[model samples]
Target: MTNWNATDLPDLTGRTAIVTGANSGLGIATTEALARAGARVVLAVRDPERGRAAARAVQGSTEVRRLDLADLASVREFAESWTGELDLLINNAGVMAIPESQTKDGFETQFGTNHLGHFALTNLLLPHVTGRVVTVSSGAHRRTKGIRFDNPNLTGEYSPWSAYAQSKLANLLFTLELQRRLAASGSPVRALAAHPGWAATNLQGRSGSAVLNKLMAIGNRFIAQDNHAGALPTLYAATQDLPGASYVGPDGPGEMRGGPALVGRTAAASDPAAAKRLWTLSEELTGVTFPAKVKTPK
Candidate 1:
């Protein structure tokens, strides 16, 4: 993988990709990279005007589509209206360490938007997806033990970081289980996961406090990598010939910033039992199930 980078992505002449939250940050970077490699990329965003504007910035073929991950109706609407084959689906949109809030579905904001929403979207669009699914997780997934199945929404007492960590852990778990199901069905489609590792992006401002947002901005200026650099792992996970369920991230000190490389996840993130349990819960919560067959454990 020497000299591996976005510039090295294979020709995607007939490929089509959908990138959620493609209006900015790593999403935009991922979109541009794919587009430049000759893929038709869909910029799926909550704001149509912004998505159109972001689509204009890409050098190659692109389109803009309305998608609000916080709303299940919107997720279904986006999937229902889509047509044709999808070579890639990048579940890139997500909220960060925000104050306790609920999505329109009454689920916790971070967990709902970051995990459940994408879970539903991927399942809904699976038939259209022929190539791969790349989910953006986080190094912060190590901050938590596992999904809070008993109280996923953290209804009683909530910590912003804890919720975010749980959501990220779910991202990895979903990838693992999705790959398992796809393989069980004898499908070629792969599911992979990646983390940005402290990239500087507008995501920092999502937290509820303006003062904290300002502090994050200042701190990121000195510590985080640019969005393009932070996006390398995602680009790698999306286009690379890696094995199914591989986790990609920066290869640097503390995985903060560097070139893309295969990375490790917490043991809890690798727990097949937890992944299966979460997958069952996700299907119940989202009301969307994959066509792929999943073997029940003995």
Candidate 2:
């Protein structure tokens, strides 16, 4: 907690880290920071060429691999093929505020790509994820009612913004519940969640929806901080003296955006009961269980 900025953090020299969506924006910046800090970083992305380019930019040991969260089959393949120990797993890859669609598995596109895919991938890689798992949830999560276990895929009427918010809430819920189960089972791996605090990333680009696009454009033009700054909170969560289920983000004004550092807030994202319920629902949906993991706290 000693002014825990990315540069002030621990050396990840011998650690192996996997960062999803490492090809661009906050993900790319996060990958670069970790690599620079001496971690052997694996660039997991949906685009191979982009991933390789990203891998080349990193300053340390780097590997580029394909990981399409839109396709559960691909997520499974990527996780299974990846072997060996993992010191950090950054579930940073995500799709936001997009048109209504579905994943290869027919789940609502946002929920599938943002939550379930990461859920399954984390489980598949559990044997390797022996150190920490940092799920990148968002402040947007504060806007949602929480994970819709009753209809996670959004089979009925849907709103893209609400869907994205729900997915992000799931991200936090996943992190909290994962830690609870790990503690119960006596595993040492810590689970943490982080947010970018409205940074200016390519992911911040305008969406198909006119109103949302206008809002993004305004943010990008006015308040959004650069990607490197946005990545700090994540970096803090991944390597610092973190507690289980901690939330980290920007240390700037209103946390809208700024330098990588440990900041705090406990909203609906910190609700324990909601997190546990979501955990059980995720395991049921993914058909994957943490073998060493125990029951989530009541």
Candidate 3:
């Protein structure tokens, strides 16, 4: 995986993929690449017009669908309306270190949108997934200790960076437990995670601090990679024939920017006990449970 790029993607003819937040940033780049490889992609976004605009730029088969991950009702609607096999689910949409806010379900915005949203969506669509589920995590996961189970929403003691970190950590733990369940159920589907080093995107402009946003803008110009480069890890994790629970990131120094490769996570991210606990909490929070057995794709 030294120099793997989007052009290296396998022929995805006849496959179908749903990419959350596919209207912009890494999500759009991923959608373009997959579509170019002959996959029928769905740009699942909160805004249908923007999704359509983005889809128009793509050269292959694509459709736009509304999906507000911040709401459980929307998540259920998106899943319940699904009709056939889903080859890949790219859980790529997320909020960064923005001001503390609650999702429509009243959970912390970062944790809810980044982790719980994908958690619920994944479980709800598990039976239809034939290949893999790729969730986009971040290196910022190292900033926090771990999930705040006692008060996951960080009710009164909320820090934007810390909250974002917790949600990212949750992404890894979710993958671990998801892979475990898939294996135990004798399913061929895999659960994987990826991070886009430091890609320049509009996500930095909404950090809720003018000074921080300006600083990130400067960094975006000089220190970060482009959308295509930043999207490599996600593409690698989604398409490669890697092992379940594999985490992919840039191969550059500090994993900031480079080609995709298997990367290491913190000990907290690798904790099976924490993974199990988080899975239980996620089920309780989302009221979505893993199916007893995932149907094998025929």
Candidate 4:
């Protein structure tokens, strides 16, 4: 298939989009593109100041809202405070290989913030949303053997990379499961997953190893693509009329780094059994059930 990109998006004049971790980097680029295409974008950021500045830099109007992915209560609070229809939701904020930490909810940082937090947020916001959603994942997901249902929090020896990998895989699983539920419930909204390849983002700021951190630091000085270029896949996933549950990444190289292009594939990403297991576990853990009214529109 030819690498797909969205240079001209469908008009989204009256739509409202909420993008998490959108204060800077790829999420900011996604916000810019979405706002430019006519949607009223919300920068869901951890820091309000950074988010406000980011909103100002984007091409279209935007609002800055606080959201700490590590805090379950904050997620619930945000969802509870929100009202009315939501056209797009982009789960874009995440952390990479960092030393072990826990959120306010007592969950491990990587799985807790990256996967569990998003999981709770999406579920809590599900009823109010009436359009498409794009979940940001990573190719590193393929590097993981699979998710550990027994210990998703990595209570054992925690390798930051593996933790990040598992979280990304969760993103894919969440996207697929969400779409299945939407189709089953007859909702018009869609769920899609995307990756930025190897764009230069601040995620590496907290590398677990000094050596790896040094290498990444040196690499960003030359090879890593800009945040704008890295945001393409996410923007495409959020705005395109593509099929639900599809994965988007760079179309160039080993899908390491490039513009917003449809690329990358993983058999594990499409494992129905794994997705269903994750879904069940997620619903149980979050105490949020999928919408039961999914039926095809007449």
Against the true structure, whose TM-score is highest? 3
Q: Candidate 1: lDDT over CA atoms?
A: 0.93
lDDT of 2 at 38: 93
Look at candidate 4 and give me any clashing residue pairs. 184-294, 185-293, 185-294, 185-295, 186-294, 186-295
**Could you give candidate 1's per-residue lDDT for residues 1-298 as a string of tens digits?**
3347788999999899999999999999999999999999999999999999888878999999999999999999999999888889999999999988899999999999999999999998888888899999999999999888999999897999999999999999999999999988878889999998889998998788889999899878999999998899999998888999999999988988888999999999999999999999999999989865322222
- Superior candidate under TM-score, 1 versus 4: 1
Worst 10 residues of 3 by lDDT: 289-298
Query: Highest lDDT: which candidate?
Result: 3
All-Cα superposition RMSD per candidate:
3.1, 3.2, 0.9, 2.1
Which digits, one per residue and each the tens of the lDDT, describe model 3 over residues 1-298? 3788999999999999999999999999999999999999999999999999999999999999999999999999999999899999999999999998999999999999999999999999888899999999999999988899999999999999999999999999999999999998889999999999999987898988999999999999999999999999999999888999999999999999999999999999999999999999999999999987686745
Off by over 4 Å in 2: 1-4, 259-267, 293-298
* Candidate 4 C-alpha lDDT tens digits along 1-298: 2344445677889999999999878888888888888999989888999888778778887988889988877888888889887888899999998888787877778888888889888888888787777889998998897889998888877788888899999999888888988887778889999998888888876776888888998887788878877888888888777899889888778787765666655777788789999989877776666655432444
The Cα RMSD of model 1 versus the native structure comes to 3.1
Off by over 4 Å in 4: 1-7, 292-298
> Could you give candidate 2's per-residue lDDT for residues 128-203 as a string of tens digits?
7777899998888877766777888777768877898999988988888888878877778898989998888887
Window of ten residues with lowest summed lDDT in model 1 = 289-298
Candidate 4, position 14, lDDT: 97
Tell me how many residue pairs clash in candidate 2.
1
lDDT of 1 at 199: 95
